[model samples]
Structures are given as C-alpha cells and as structure tokens.
Target chain A: MNGTARHRILRGCRALALAASMLGAPALACTDAPRGTGDLGLIVERAAGRLQLVETTGLTALGAIDGLGDLSHASLVYSRDARYAFVFGRDGGLTKVDLLCRRIEARVLQAGNSIGGAISQDGRLVAVANYAPGGVKVFSSDTLELLADIPAEYEPGKRAKVVGLEDATDGRFVFSLFEAGEIWVADVREPRAPRITRLRNIGAQPYDALVTPDGRWYIAGLFGEDGLALLDLWEPEKGVRRILDGYGRGQEPLPVYKMPHLEGWAIAGRHAWLPAIGRHEVLVVDADTWQEVARIPVAGQPVFVMARPDGRQVWVNFALPHNDVVQVIDTHTRALVETLHPGKAVLHLEFTPRGEAVWISARDDDKVVVYDTATLAPRATLPADKPSGIFFTSRAGRIGL
Target chain B: MPARHLELRHLVEHDCGSCHGMTLAGGLGPPLTPSALEGKPLEYIEAMILRGRPGSAMPAWDAMLSEDDARWIARYLKAGTRK
Candidate 1:
C-alpha cells in the first residue's frame, strides 16, 4: 500500500499493454490468433473483377482474388456453412470460392450476361438472373454443376431478360420478366424439372423484384408502369395485385442518372423502406398492407435504403453527384436523424449482423469506411479499389440475401 | 465543349460511369468507345443521352443536362477518351 508497491503495479500494467500491442492483440490480456475465414467478408473491386477479402472484426483486408470475369453488376451468396462464396458476375461467371483457402474452387460462365443471383432456402441450388439470352439458370451450390436451365421465353422462340430473381422458402424461386411484363414462380422442389407458374401481363417493364424476409410476397417494381406489382407466394392463385398505383402519375420524375437499386429495400418492424426511383425520397410502405404510408425526403436520389439488424434505424445512400453523403432515419419517428459525408461516390452501405457497426464503400475515394452505429463516428478506414458491395459471412444463415 | 467541360466530362466518366464503366467501357449499358460509336451518328448518341431509352435501365438526362452537355458527352464518348 506504499509508493514502491504502486510503482511496481503500474510498471507491470505497462509491460502487459506493450506485450499485447506487440502480439497484435487488444489491450486486454488474452491470447487469440487473428480472425479466421469464418469471420471474413468481401468487397468487390468491380472493374478488376476481383474481391478483397477482409476480416469483419478487425476491419482489415486479408487478400484479394482475381479472374472473376465481369463483376460490374456482380452479387454474391454465401454457402450455408459460411466456408464458401458463390459469386455471380455480370459476364455470367458463376464462381465458387473457398474462404478458408482464400482461392476460387470452381468457376464457369453460365450465361451471356447476368445481373445477380440467389441461393435456395436450403443453400443447395444457386439461381442467376440473366439479361442476354435471357433466363434464370439454377446450379448446384457445391460444384457449380449445371442442374437446370429455364429460359425466360416471353413467346415461342422469343426471350425476355429476367431480373429481380429471389429464392423463397420450400425451394421456390421468383423473378420478373423485363420485356414480357410477367412474374414467374418456379418451384424447384424437383431441381431438374422446375414447375413454373406464370402470371402474365402483371405490369410493364418490371425492372427489379424482391421477396420479403418471410418469403411470402414477391414485389416487382415496374419501370414502364407507375405502380409495383405484388405476388403473394403463399397464394399464387390470388395472382398478381397492383399496389401504389400511379406513384408518378402527376409528376415528372427528375432525370435519374442511375436506376434505383431494389435490393436496397429495408424492412424495419412492419414497414418497408424503398427507394423512390428518380426521386430524392424513400417510400415507407406497410409490409403487410402493401400500401404507401409515408415518404421521407432525403439529400439525394436514394439508392440503398438498408435497415440496421435491430430494426431501429434505416440508412440510405444516394446516387451521384450527391453520392458523397449518407443519411440515417429513425424507424420509429420515420425522420432523418443524421447525415454523414462518407467520401466520394458512396456506392454501398452494409451494417454488421447485430447493428453494432456499418461499413460504407466509396468508389471514387477508393476506401471502405467503417463507423460505429451507436456513436455515428468513424472507426476504421481501409484502402480499396473502386469497391461497390460489401458482403458479410453472417449472410450465410439468412434467407433472401 | 464549354467552360464547365471538364466537370461535364467527369460526370460522364463518373456519374454516367455508374452504369457505363468508369473508363466508359460499359457495364449495364453498352460500351461508348470510339470503335463502338464508329457507325453511330453524333445526333443519335446525343439524343440517347438527352432522352434515355424508356422501358430500359437508361434514364433521360435532359432535365439535368444542357444540350451542350449532351453534345459534349456524345463527342467525348465517341472520341473514346479514358479517365
């Protein structure tokens, strides 16, 4: 209890802190290796057709993998085990990557052009939505094996580009036909012989579609029509219904430099936050009623309106010239709470599983910025090359990712 | 090209670059390189810029872009200048 004893304790604490830093551990006393692939995620370097592997916990990049083909509009789905990544590239490249080995296990060009893809509920089948020679192709998630090919033919010998492909429960896949104005639900219960149920003339130019988290509803946003077409997967006999009719009826939408990404739909509680195409607003629609409840004006054309996992707040990003800013809205009040300038051309925003932190990808600045969700303060910044989408391993367990 | 030519050009290279590649090699949209635009007319390209092809991913830029801006983008795209 004297000066010499206190000095000794202080020196011992200092020595422990120094050793922890030297061992690349946190200041606290514990011995653990750096994160493994199970704790890792990916950031797409679009132009290079590569992915930067990163450890989600440390906010540090592990390595980069190349030869991914065209990744400009690429999207990925992780295996159920969280040990593999199924990357669907724009050039129709279906690649299965082993996270542990940090290398591609298998790769194949499945189509001429693809927009994105989905994994089945059981994580057994991988489905890709194609734009050219259009259709949806289902592959075995394990080896990228060609399981079944369902060409999206609008008419006999005439094909239509498919978009918004999402896998629902019970091994069912739903997607919209861009040119045919139809929505098809393919029951892949029998993988090779997919039983397709088509609802024709649902709307005009269905740009993109998404399924609710519960996998009950398939909503397609129409480009040629003002309203969105909704299909109740549970009751396909009910057919497609129209919701939010004449959304752009009286107003001329401002020039949209980039199409609003529908994958940005965020469901918080009972309301769904969706980006209003060509508008600087995020539409809050009742998930159950499928009706517009409120419209939250934002700083720019809202591109991605993602909700934190806890469903308390929704984060929105904008399309360029205003892509430098990001805004967070309190879901309870449906009000904009804060806006942060992440960097130049904020392309994508992703929140950690528990909503503890959010990662933002700024393409122009070539940096991935991570921020603490509660404090709204920057935590770490890692250099990247034109990063677009950030995907976490936690997605492996979720449906409709 | 006008006084804000660089800005507009960057817009094509960056903003339009969102769909079209940053280098204008094309992603969702077709490539805008000189070789690809060789047979296409400048007026057609400018029209496509000002009034986007509806029912597709392209959106009209006439609201935010001046005629000069559209023409500059058309010319720049046809010239195949990379960023």
Candidate 2:
C-alpha cells in the first residue's frame, strides 16, 4: 500500500468505533489504531479466561481477547517497546498478546502451574515462576519459545516452588524458592546457558517476593516464620540477610485467609512500607537500617502496600472480610490519611504511569473504578467480569513490576 | 433459600477461588476438583470447611459459612459443576 493509502487506512481504523467483543468474537479487524500504547493497559477477566485491552486516558476498554486458561491470580508484563504484553496464566500458559492488534500473537504451556512472570532487562526474554514442577523457565519475548529451565531443587529429588521472579539491571533474573527457604539468581547474559547462584536457608515458605524499584534488593516474605529475606544484587557475594526479624515476636498470628504478596511493597522516601503476614498492621521500616520504625494498624491483614509515584501517599488493600476496603497512609505523618471502599472484593489496584490516577479492580462488582489521585474521588467505572489484576503498558519501562 | 444458595456458590467460586483456583485445580492450595477428592470422604470435606487445617494458610470458613453451606459446597465440588 502507498503512503496515502496507508494513512487513509489508519484514519479509517481510528474512526471506526471499537466494539469490545464480550461474546468471544474477533475484537476488531482493522485494529491498528494509529496510536502508541503508552497509556494502554489490560484487565484480567480471571473467570472467563480473557483480557480486556484498555486505554488509561479514555478510561475505557478497547476490546477483549480470549482463550487464556486458568487466569486465577494472573499477571502480565510488557515488552520494552510497550507493544506486546506477556500474560502469565495460572495454568502455566504464557500468552504473548498484541495490544495493538488485539489478539494472541503466541502462547505456550510452560509448566503444570505457574504463579507469575517478569520480562528481562532488555525485554528480549520473559521468565515465568512455576509452582507445579517448581522452577523458572525463560522464553524468547518475541516467539514465546523455551530457551532455558532452572529448577528450584533444594534437595535431591525434591523441588521447591519458585516465586517473586524479577529482572535486575543487567541480564540477570532473581527469584525465591518457597519450600526450600532459598533464593536463586540466574544470570541470563547467555539466554540458553544461565549462570546460577543459589543462596540457601534464607527463610521458610517465602509465599511471595519483590525486587526493589532500582533492582538493588530482592526481598522475600516468609509465611512459615517471622521476617523477610533480603539479598542485595549489587553484593551477591555477601549472601542473604534476614530483615524485620521477629516483628511477630510476642503476638499470635491471626488466620491469614489469603497469602500476602510482596509485589505491592513500596519504598517511599526513606522507609519501606511492608505488609505483615497474618497481622492487621503495615510495618514501616527504615530502608537503610531495615529496622521497624512504626507498625501502622490497618483495617485487616494487609495484602498490597503500594506507594504513589511521588511517594507522598501509600495505598493498602486487605485480605478477606476486609478486602473491600482500601486505606492510604501519609508516609511523612505515618498515619492513616483516608479510607475508601471501591467495591466488593477489591482484588488489585494500579496507579497510572505518573500517579495522577489509580484503577482498582473489584471482582465481585465486575467493574474497575478509576480514582483521581489528587482528590481521591471516583473518576470513572468500566465494567468487566471477575476482574483481578490491572496492568498498564507504563510498566514496560520500569525495572521490576 | 435459593438466593442464599447461589450466593454460597459464588462465595466458593470467587472467595475460595482466590487460592483454590477458579476451576478448583489448585494454586498455592491443593486442588478441590472431584478427581482430587475422589477417595476423600464427604464428611471430611465438609468438616474441613468448618474447621480448616491448622498451621496452614487455609482459614476456617465457619465464620462466614454455616454447616449446611459447607455440606452443600462439599457436594458441589464433588459434582464438578462446570461454569
């Protein structure tokens, strides 16, 4: 096609109203919207095994793509260019979705069960943290082709489930082994042949973990014990050190209805806001010293303790019985600033790239509510079905999301 | 009774599905599928609903669900009612 013809086609595509195919039909034929995906994102319809491609600026879903299997607790990472999204399904299916085309580009079942995944530093590779066979697998970001597999073998014939896999500054991937109380860093400078470094006895039952914004520290939250394991990627030779040691020192743990995920951890200003497992408090710790500064009691067991881009306010969601509520804390005052109920069973929340707005997903309500960060007022509500995780293409540029 | 029964079902699929997997095949928790519970007795499943396994992440649903609700869920899982 000539330049004018191409321009006409692009204009026509943008002129056409996008019909979000909720009935499993092809989303749109002429889907090249003649725009960038910077403000675009995806919402996981976990029960229906589909994803609704949405744009943050309009606060509306462009279309829906289906056929993803067992998306329970699903997550997605974007390519460096922010064009493609690598969706990691709970059924071990890694689907490469074309955000512009609104279709599945490539997909593969990498394991029996998978928790989540992260894109490599250069965005050339995508890594998945597996639960069934207990390992991490690397795939070509473009083709979804398996390149390497690193099993979390803590003992002979025994493998522990891998969690908290993330990308560091270089071509390295870091993750934690849940059952073995270990952390593994795989250097994928050479994709097929990874250089493995294992740090053992970090802590027991690391339910989930997260890498710091700068990819400096990898922290794993322990479910079997008190405290977390922190490994400095800059100084791996120093081994792992336990931080926030025994915050549960004299308290009895309330029943944790759901496992607290460290993915939502935040380091605002000089302190790190972390969720205390089986406890109703959000632990405020000095990032440099790793000492407990203040424990801010919340509405319930905190699930995600997230920070706004400005680091002025921190938002937290809860586990069952209190999952409907979201509380914000002012880092400076170290006090609860606001409390709001987005809807029933609020599963996940994501702030816009610059933190001007936040989108929260309430599974029971089947809608994602957008809130203005400044006023903390509801901006818009987009309907969905059993929505869980909201991932924006802005994460494409971040180190560890 | 029917409305509450449907709510209980939704609770099982959504609330319990948070950990048990929506299809009940399992994630961090064990599978609640019919095949995964073939040999397990119905009473055991119902009792587990009321009194969750101690020392594990599973919390007793007795606070939210009644004995009748637990029994209904046990049968519902064994039936493997497809969504």
Candidate 3:
C-alpha cells in the first residue's frame, strides 16, 4: 500500500493495456485489407425502378438514380482513353458516366422498347436494338445525341423484333431480328443518318450477333434454327452464307425429343463458342470455316458466352437446367478448365479490357458478382436493387460512373 | 385420403418432380426423399416451396401455389420414400 508499490502496479497495468492494443491492431488492419482489395463497382438494375450504384470492395451502398425504368439489359462501354463509360440500357436509356466520380453526368432517351445495344470500337457511337418497332437507334457516344433510326426489313408475314445489336470492326452495325430469321447491315459512317444497304436472311429467328476482332465476317445464333449462321460481311451484296446447319445438338435429326434452342454466341480468336440453350453442351466452331470443331459438355443450358481480350479463355453462363456456376473453357485445349460458382442465374458477363477481372450480373440474386480473372474466385458481390444489363467501359483505369 | 394422395402423387410426377428429379433423387435440385429431409421439418419444405432458397436455381412458387398447396407438397414428400 506504499506510494512506490502503487506506482509499480500502475506501470504494470499500462504495459498490459499496450500489449492488448498491439494484438487488436492486426485485426483492424485485416478489415481494411479486405475492403480495398475485394471488388470495385456494382450497378444494380431494379425492375421498373432506378439503378443502384454500390461499392463492393468497401461494402458501401453508393445510392441510386431515378428514371431508368425496367432495365431488361445493360452494357458498359468505356472509351479507349479510359476517361468515361457509356451505360446503354434495354429501354433505350443512355447515360454517360464519369468513371472517377461514379456519377451519371448525362442521360438520354434514344427511343422506345429497346432491348440491347453496343458501342463502336472508336467509342464515338452507340447502336441500340429496338424490340417493339423492329429497328436500331444510333446515337453519339460523347454528346448522348440521337444519330439515326434505321428501319429493319422483315420477312413476309413475320413480325420482326430486334433483339441484339453489335458494331462490327468495319464501321458497320450488325443487328439480329429475333423472330424474323434475318440480320440487317447498316453503314454508320454518318452517325446521324445510317443507310441500310443489305438485308440477309440467316435462319430461324436470329437472337444475337458478334463480329470477329479481325472484322472480316460476323456470326449470329439462330434461336429457332438451333444453329449459327456465318455471314461474309466483307461482301454485303452477296449476303450471309449458311455455313453451318444444326450447329448445336438438337432433335431435328433424331427420333427422340431434343431441346434445340441455340441462344448465345461469341467469337474469341478463331473459335466461336455457342451456348446451346436446349442442350447441356457448348458448341465450339472455327470462326474462319464455320465448322463445328468441338462440343464441350457443360452443366446447364449455357446462355451467355464471353471471351477475355487475351483470347485464352471463353466463359459460358448457364440460364436453364439449373446450375449455379459459370463454366470457363480453355480455347487452346478446347476443354473446361474451371467452373466459377458465383450464386445463381448468371445472365450476362463482361470482362475488363485488361482481362484482370470479370463482372457477372446474376438476375436471381439481383447482384453483380465480380471474380478475379486469374484465380476465378468470387472476390466481391455488388448488390443491385433489381439487377440486369451489365457493361464495362473498354476505356482503361476509369470506373464506369 | 386416397383421392388426395393420388392427386398429390400425380402433381409430383407431372408438375414438381419433372424438374427436381424423377424419383425425387435430385437432378437439378437436391433430393426431396425422406432420407434427404432428415432433421428438417415439413415447415422447411413448405417455406422452400413458397419463398425458394435465395441465390439458388429454385424459384419461388408463391404466385402459382397457395399455402395449402405447399403443405400438400411437403406431406407428399414426407410420406413417399424411395426404398
């Protein structure tokens, strides 16, 4: 009970507190590490509501933007300079996002009943597929101004619907008619006024189209035809050639019943990965010859096919047959290398320019799942109020505002 | 009781088990047999049918089925065992 004894006890207690604080330091640091390194941004599309911006890495809810109603699809196209991202939606709503601020600077309503759209390679223009009117609307990327509304030609007695639109490397916009069994080619040299030069009959109900990086030709998945149609974009006058028929396995040639709806297609390098919506396998075709090179067995109905910029791996998203994973195929081996089980109903997938990360929009979970490109592990999940339409800007270093 | 059992059995064969499984053995979903339901109650099955398991392939049947309909499904699942 002396003064010296009391001082010694106080010193011992101080040292004990310091030791405890040191132990707690590591745990606090661990929390910070997970926040910065987890995931970047998630844009959630709520059905008949606004788009919610979420910071996945920090687990911070950024807030929402009103007026983007019932977004059925969305694609984020970053400028080549990586300065900004043009967020294109299915409802014909275009928003110019300042990637750094993650804020919508400009909003433009291009047309009505738009289902999907794509930005030009130069990032100067965006072409949208109008579903109800059966046409495409071209707009200026920088100003969010309407450029052209090209009318699509349909088959006799068949009402047409434009389901997918993609800008070919050759400065032309290729559009797929959902129920018309045709694809229209339009020249967009003058962004404001597109001149429709050719209308080619591909097959039964073309759903989606993709042009090879080389820009020599384009390929489309025929929903009712259950095959892929290869087009010679080089000669628009001669029209598209039905290079491959019954490209996906179906019951058309069999005595038994088969699910033959070929829904999604993508081209990486010289190979085209087609997700057979009716079957449990992905059909790989040689982009040059349009020949069925290989059929890779997958778990469910593969709905979306995307390839990394390096052309090394092709990712397929399953829609039906009920699988909660994205299957990655090695292009060189033509084999299933890895399966990314991120949650459920992965509808759309887009890869960053560097191929360092992948953004997956899962409809069932209403969240965008971000996976590390190298590890293929779920690094973060961006929760959307009602998620749909995922696109990343091709422009590097800038976040899609 | 026989009529109800037959109706429930018909529903399992046609509507429910077609996608889930043939013998409730789990094709697209987990098996719904008695062994698989071990430690789980009928309320769990009913809730799964109503709300569905989030982040899963199973979809909510709340709009399509009533509470009584879900209870019937759970009862049928409990009674039928693939032995």
| Most accurate candidate by DockQ | 2
- The regions of model 1 sitting more than 4 angstroms off are A1-38, B1-38, B54-57, B62-69, B79-83
lDDT of 2 by residue, A143-224 (tens): 8889999888889999888888988888999998877888889999999999999898898888888888888988888888
Put down candidate 3 lDDT per residue, A7-104, tens digits, no spaces. 55445445544565788722111111112212334364635445555443344555555555444445555555553556655455677764333345
- Please give the distance, in angstroms, between residue A55's alpha carbon in candidate 2 and its true position after superposition: 1.4
Candidate 1, residues A1-401, lDDT tens digits: the string is: 46685466456555666777799955633113322445678899887889988887878887788889877767898988787899988777899986654667799998877888999999899999987778999998987889899999989999888889998988899999988999999999999999999999898888888887777888898877688998988898899999999877788776667767787479899999998876788999998788899999999888888999988999999876688999999999887999999899898888877879999999879999998989899999999987889998888887678
Interface RMSD of 1: 3.2
Model 3 stretches with alpha carbons more than 4 Å out = A1-42, A48-66, A153-159, A248-269, A321-323, A395-401, B1-83
Give the DockQ-based CAPRI class for model 1.
acceptable
TM-score of each predicted structure versus truth: 0.87, 0.93, 0.65
Write the number of the candidate with greater DockQ, choosing between 2 and 3.
2
Candidate lDDT values, in order? 0.83, 0.88, 0.61
DockQ of each: 0.40, 0.68, 0.03
